[model samples]
Target chain A: MNLSLTLTINGEQREIVLDDPRVTLLDLLRERLHLTGAKKGCDRGQCGACTILVDGQRINSCLALAISYDGSAITTIEGLAENGALHPVQQAFIDHDGFQCGFCTPGQIMSAVGLIAEAQADGDAERIREAMSGNICRCGAYQGITEAVLDAQAKISTGKERDAA
Target chain B: MNRFEYVRPTSIAEAVAAAGEPGSAYLGAGTNLLDLMKGGVTQPSRLVDLTHLPDLGQIEQLPDGSTRIGALVKNAALAHDPAFAEAFPAVAEALLSGASAQLRNAATVGGNLMQRTRCAYFTDPASACNKRAPGSGCDAIGGENRAHAVLGWSDHCIAVHPSDFCVALTALGAIVEIEGPAGRREVAMTDFYLLPGDTPEKETVLDAGEMIVAVRLPAEAAAFAGNQRYLKGRERTSYAFALASAAAALKIENGLIVEARLALGGVATKPWRVQAAEAVLAGAAPGKEAFEKAAEVAFAEAKPSGDNAYKIALGKRVLARALMMAAAGTPERMPALPASPFAPLPEGVVNV
Candidate 1:
């Protein structure tokens, strides 16, 4: 069954006409919208490789049906940067050496961004590790990833404080 | 994945009517259902999207101080809600312990209850799984049956329900409210999930076209809100299914156990409640001996398979430790058990 869905992707509203109801959000992003930043690692919800923010919450895009999210705003790794400046999380990934092969970097950055927005972890390394447990990096770069999330959280918090001031 | 028709229903009636159609399934978060569909495990002809239904995404306190969590309430939201966490800490912990943060954000309460087993054999359509295809034979009975059920297993299927939240709900005596073509009805959480009896295919007691509206937690459970613990034993600290888990709540007055509620997960075909275990603890002193006895009673009927005999001992220790932790009022400090004995499987092999 074909369904028409209008999704606000990366702050831009895009109308999608799906011929199949089974297409996942990950597929819609990569195949239709050409937002290839979200990689498909497991194609299942087990791996967080397809993590994206839907309405400011991190979720596995591979498991989310594109048709089910009609009016939802989706934020992918590509959406993290604004005005040609890297998001704090994306910058922290580079500063902390958070990626070895970089296959899972987009997912990791997206998850970290979503976690910070949720105000979890609160700059605790253990809490950040637990919060980011869903996104796996088989390259054994967890130490760097943890440091990056913690660093990014601090930067984001400082940025928020400056904005409030 | 099979091609299916999709219908977005804005009301409970529309959802029920759409779901009443032949071979229709309600799509909440699609966390598990989509995975199953991608694996060709389940092929529903139509999907009735229930996300459009208004007023079904709330977590509210009933007038009597009971908690009414709508079926569409996300797991992460419920786990982090101040009132819900204060009222049911163990349940909140259980929900948090399950899946990844990303999954919990997308997963819904009703979807968690309706999730399918994580049995490797059941998920692998190539394998013979009675739950997947009736009379196809269960390969897990003799093939890598480590994660298979030890408590409730018929000759047909030994798969276990993998919801950690449901285990806590069973321990809390939660009630499931359902609305269907036959009107509204309520079923205790303990009775909501069915055992793999002869028909392993039929998992829940919800009749055709019945949709879970909400799960109502009784006000009495709030009394023991501070005295509950959910101990999940898995291969990893997170993002892994439980090998054996215990959800325990105790009411102790002056060192004497006044009431006890206990349920086991990941070791049974369903969220298993052992009234016998609770009975053993009731009226007894809160000590190691009483806790050990309760654990024994909890696993008295466990019939383990070849690779999963360790679960018997593991389940006993987990239950005993959970009881002791609940009694000590240190549920928050309850540590994760040692790595699962079933872990470190061969490469490319997933835990069933």
Candidate 2:
């Protein structure tokens, strides 16, 4: 049976039709919408290569069914940057050399952004490491990745305070 | 993955009715179900999505001071919830230590409880797994059985349940509330999981259409929450399945143990609760000797395979350590040890 779903992707409403009910959000984004920022490493939940933000919560999109999130808001890595400026997390990743092969970069950055949004990436290095453990970089760049997440968290928190002021 | 029909029901009655249909599976977070579907292990003709049910994602305190956690409440939210953490710290810690933050964000409490074992044989469609395909022989029995169960495992199946949250819930004496086409009912957490006896395919006592509504923590368990601890020993520091884990809670008065609740995971086919061990700790002082005695009684019935015999000793040590730690009120001090004796040593490393 063909299913039609309407999802708010990157703050914009997008409607899509699926011929197979087993299509995952990761497949819908990469194959249908051509939003290939989310990579499919294992096609299973074990690898965090398909991490995305669903209603501001970090989840593995490869395991999430597209139809289950019909009316939810999704934020992929492509949606992080706005107005021709890189998001703080993206810039922090580049500045800290958080990646080597860059295959897991998008997922790492998206998870980092969601962590900050969830207020889970506190200033503690151990906390940031544990939170970012979902996204694995085979290049062994975890030290740099942990550093980038902490740096981006500080930037995000400061920006929020400034906006409030 | 199979092409299945998906229906999102707006009400519990409709959801339960749809689930009662032939070859229908309830989809909570789809973390475990989707993975199994991708592995070609499970093929459901229909998926009844429970996410759309109203008021199924809430976490509230009942009038009896017990907490009622909805079936759809995400694992990450339960771990970070201030009230839940305050009432049951070990439950929060166990949830946090199970999966990554990303998976936990999508996984729900009900789904976590219903997750299947991570046995390689069960996941591989070609392997002979009695749990996956009835009448088939178990590959883990004669194959690589390093991760097989050491307790409550039948010859038909040696797989262990891969849930850390259930172990803690069993120790805390939680109750699982279920809703179905028949009526509403409650099942004790200890009875929620089933041993892998001759009927390894039948995991839980729930009927086909029965759905878990919420998990209730009794108000009496609150008194021992501060002294509870969930300790998991894995191959790595994080993101790995437990090798031998323990969930322990001690009620100590005047430096003597008045009551104790102990359950084990990662080494049993189900959440292994040992009342004999608890009986041993009833009037004894909280120390290493008492903990050792209790651990001995807990593992007196353990039957391990050839490759997994090390788990027998490891499970004992883990349970003893968890009991002592819970009694000492130091749950966060999980000390790291060197490589296991069973593991191959490094090239240049010398063993004493």
TM-scores, in order shown?
0.95, 0.95
Prediction 2 TM-score vs. true: 0.95
- Give candidate 2 misplaced runs (Cα > 4 Å): B330-352
Residues B1-352 of candidate 2 have per-residue lDDT tens digits of 8878898998999999999998999999899999999999999999999988889899999999898999999999998897787778778878878888899999999999899999999999999999999989999988998998999899899998899999989988999999998999999998988887888999998998999999999988888866777778888656778889888898889989999989999999998888899999999988878888999999999988548999889888888877766776733321122111232322322322
Q: Evaluate model 1: give its TM-score.
A: 0.95
lDDT tens per residue, model 1, A62-95: 9999999999999999888889999889999999
DockQ of 2: 0.62
Q: In angstroms, give how far residue B114 of model 1 lies from its true place.
A: 0.4
Clashing pairs in 2: none
Which tens-of-lDDT digit does each residue in B1-352 have in candidate 1? 9988889988999999989988999999999999999999999999999988899899988899889999999999998897788778888878888999999999999999999999999999999998999999989987998988998789999998899999999999999999999999999998998889899999999999999999999999988876787878888887889999999898888879899999999899999999999998889998778888999889999988648999999999888877766776633431322122322222322222
B121 in model 1: Cα distance from truth in Å? 1.3
- Model 1, which residues run further than 4 Å from truth? B330-352
TM-score of chain B of each: 0.94, 0.93
The Cα error of candidate 1 at residue B18, in Å, is: 1.3
